[model samples]
Target: VESATRTAIEAIRTGIGTKPETEIADATEAEAPVREVISLLGIIDGAESDILVPDADDKCPGGYFHCNTTAQCVPQRANCDGSVDCDDASDEVNCVNEVDAKYWDHLYRKQPFGRHDNLRIGECLWPNENFSCPCRGDEILCRFQQLTDIPERLPQHDLATLDLTGNNFETIHETFFSELPDVDSLVLKFCSIREIASHAFDRLADNPLRTLYMDDNKLPHLPEHFFPEGNQLSILILARNHLHHLKRSDFLNLQKLQELDLRGNRIGNFEAEVFARLPNLEVLYLNENHLKRLDPDRFPRTLLNLHTLSLAYNQIEDIAANTFPFPRLRYLFLAGNRLSHIRDETFCNLSNLQGLHLNENRIEGFDLEAFACLKNLSSLLLTGNRFQTLDSRVLKNLTSLDYIYFSWFHLCSAAMNVRVCDPHGDGISSKLHLLDNQILRGS
Candidate 1:
């Protein structure tokens, strides 16, 4: 290290190279700020600069790095990623793991995290009331902190993620975001939030807010326009909540939303336009709800880009023809329903589907034509259904049928008042498979 520092000192003393300002003026196009791809190959490429360091003349630069001995430089992001750019290896020493970069990034910006370590077990610190800052700018991790209310005066505005999970907050007030307006993601799962004030996120639409996770909350109902339109949000997670109803205007502003999760809710009814505003929605998780029926009118318009739809563990008794208007649907989960039969036209519209799960239903019979249009289907699960016979034409059009699982029965003895050789019932080893030759008959 001392030798390298002496060499640098000698290089500085002997005017063998041009000054740093002249090199900057000759290399770049008169300060056209290069946005991305800051490579440090100038070491071997023999460019004007030794490394991708910021020009010495540019004032108020965004980011830069400098070595201790050789005066070489690298980008700020290249510090802790298993590389030794400095002559003294200072950048790699005491480096935190990349996965835990959030913690170090906050510490680098002088945000507080461990100040309340001496506070009472269940207490919280209000903004500027305890420490100089309210929460960390990269993250507001108060998990398991037993917080009741979110304070009003946060110190930073450019928050990337605010996590308050496992707390005891019951409601979300409009003033909750009065200070932290630029938070991109908010996670409040297991916080017991029952109600969010209308317009709680008033000015967040103009910010970069994208994902909102409120799973495992106590919200029984949400007001209309919960998130304003043109918000550019992509994912919304409300799973394991007590939500029971949905209106058309519930998502008027979430046109760019891609995934919506309402699993384990009590929603039994919704308007035809429930998903009308989400044109780019690709994944919809409605499993474990109280849905009773599905029809074409239930979806007023087609979801052209929808790829996965889950309605499992519902009370679905009837599925109308053309129920799902998604032409790009690849996976459909209807298992654990109460359907007794699948009509011939029920699944005729799902031509692009690859997997269909009807397992654990009370289904007694289904027309082979219902599956004829599913030319691309590879997996069909009908396990645990009471099937007395299987149609010979079931596998005729299943050109891409790669897997089929169904329970087979042999005899229904009136004397025993029970089914005898049911494969799934009596654990009997069958001589011939039920899904191989198409026609299934009992003894």
Candidate 2:
């Protein structure tokens, strides 16, 4: 490979020497990046030959082996089959015995039986060539490899991202990601992961890893210190899992997390002060869970930076007073729940909220001052509820409302000052005015 690179560089020098002085100077002034090809040299007669000329700059694509001595690109499966594929016979030189090959097959699929050198693709060189994982730029993408364990042989230097989605790691042992310390983003989505050992993520302490995605797994609960102390994780997604409950220590050290998605889990409740340590949390998704109530104890007062909180499609039957302690909350989703009433103090502290979603509930009535504190609420969704009548005075204080939705067209009459009201006239109503259904009016 080195000789091939030198020959290419010398050819460029010779070409430049034959060019005009002005042309050579113009070429030197240009700063275009050049990719030198170092494999598969053509013969002098302009005919393809079987002779393999090694080039240092060229690399094989994934699923192919690079024969260094001959610069030949052969299929990876052709190695160690007792065949002389390469001109230098590098493929069959490191063949292992049949007995050892069977032993290493389940542990390291491509080692001992074949070559164990680093796999090269483009400019990225990964430490292991077993799984055929390709590296693009600084990302090592090993998605859908059905890997049972974490890839232990990673490049020594820090990587930017590693995606190992759709594997089968039933349990994540301790120090799962310690091999690549400085990886900023790690995606392990759809890995069928069942349990994560305690201190599994302890190596992320003071590291630059910002995003972690372990959604679509079978995690029953979060291990203690799931995120190490002083870690820099920003976005964490554990959605579509089997998390049954939460504890305060499960999130002890994640002070920098901004978004925490626990949606589509089986979480029924959380311990007190469970989220008190996450002071910077802005977006929390607990939708499609089994939460039955919301009280001050479960949601502490330390969530000062929370902006969007989703509790949609849960089993929430009650929302105690002062449930939302976030001062700057903008959007709150409570749709598809079992709440039957909107009390006066249910949303008293959400003075800065702009959107409120209470659709698809069992709401029957609201207190006179239910929305008096929502002065900045611009969007309200009350559709798919069981409410029969809505008083205009209940929504009078919402002067900034731009849109409101309801199941019946008649409810739009009570939405005063709202610029847009949905269900402009169902089959039984008209745009001019609401049609009070006889069944709902007890006719």
Instruction: Name the top TM-score candidate.
Output: 2
Q: What is the RMSD of candidate 1?
A: 26.7
lDDT of 1 by residue, 133-164 (tens): 23443455667778776544443555666666
Model 2 lDDT on a 0 to 1 scale: 0.71
lDDT tens readout by residue for model 2, 107-199: 222211012134345346444444346775566777788887667755445677677888888888985665654787888889999889988
RMSD, every candidate, angstroms: 26.7, 29.3
lDDT of each: 0.64, 0.71
Off by over 4 Å in 2: 1-132, 152-158, 427-443
- Give the Å error, residue 79, model 2: 71
Which candidate number would show the highest lDDT if scored against the true structure? 2
- Clashes by residue pair, model 1: 229-253
